[model samples]
Target: MSEVQELTKTKEKPLWYVVFTYHNAEKRVEEHINSLAKTEKYDGLIIKAEVPVQKRTVSRRGKIKEIEEKIFPGYVFVKAVMTPEVMAAIRRINGVAHFVGGGNEPVPITPEEVKRARIQDDLSEEFKAGDTVMITDGPFENFIGKIIKIEGRKINIALSLFDREMGIDFSPEQIMKIQ
Candidate 1:
């Protein structure tokens, strides 16, 4: 193939690269890259930016809430046809620490890794409220508890402690449904 043909072939397929950003700046970096991608100069070279996140349930002060937590904090995945200009522009963006690779060149992430990172854990579908579960890990191991509430991946269970009924929150991995 001719040099021009090779270049065209390469540019046709955008690759996913990992960009390291400042603390708590993943979203900012992703937005900046995506906005720049829409501009004429970067229209074809920069495809899109993504910050993989998963829904999480947290109980604070007896209140259950669902939150989106970053799967990889301080990192953003950018899909683009990487070139010298594109890489330079990304590095110049605020909050972007650097591209994740050796030396000054950025390395593309494998498709398998990207797919794995995007997978969200939906543990709430496996168990429901009012179900009996046994604590599988932590100090409450082997203890039986009744599920009182389930928020995303967090499960609130009521169990006997010190002869008193109390509620505690646990992740799906920390509890198993009683058959």
Candidate 2:
């Protein structure tokens, strides 16, 4: 309520900034930023760094595996009190290219956009293995296939392509029940 208190509150308020990293370096950048948060230079100024990811099922060589895929590749979200020194330090981190939203001034991410980026696709309860489905998106759109495996939010389907059965993995939203 006091002037000094108000100043302190506004100064400490953290906003989410988007940092662009090199190809396949989102995780590394996030870790580096987090590690720097504990050091004297970044203490309090840097709050947290996060790379949004979702669990996906992948099929390779007849083996079904779950993998965590980045929701937004090459980007990491960082919560921090924006300061010139902090921005410079982030840019200096290895694997981090620069902050998004133009040159020196970086824009903070909107709360809505952050929420959407963090949302995880839920597995459809109505779908199960052996169920016939129709591909709704991607290169196999409208193609009919049979569910081969259900792992987490990924649905492995067997589709006839070029007269041969090919195994493919899709998110639940990409396929619908044939019935």
lDDT of 1: 0.82
Per lDDT, the best of the predicted structures is 1
Candidate 1, residue 176: how far the Cα is off, in Å? 46
TM-score for each prediction? 0.62, 0.61
Q: Write the per-residue lDDT of candidate 1 for residues 1-179, one digit (tens) a residue.
A: 76434443453445789999999998889899989999999976787888988999999899999999898999999887788899999999999999999888998887578679884334454567898877768999878889999887679999999999999999766876654
Cα displacement (Å) at residue 29, model 1: 0.8
Clashing pairs in 2: none
How accurate locally is residue 144 in candidate 2, as Cα lDDT from 0 to 100?
Answer: 82
Residues 1-179 of candidate 2: C-alpha lDDT, one tens digit per residue = 76434443354445689998999998888888989888997766887888898999999999999999888999999887789889889999989888899767999877578678883323443567898877767999868889999887678999999999999999765765654
Off by over 4 Å in 1: 1-12, 119-179
Question: Residue 177 in candidate 2 has what lDDT?
Answer: 62
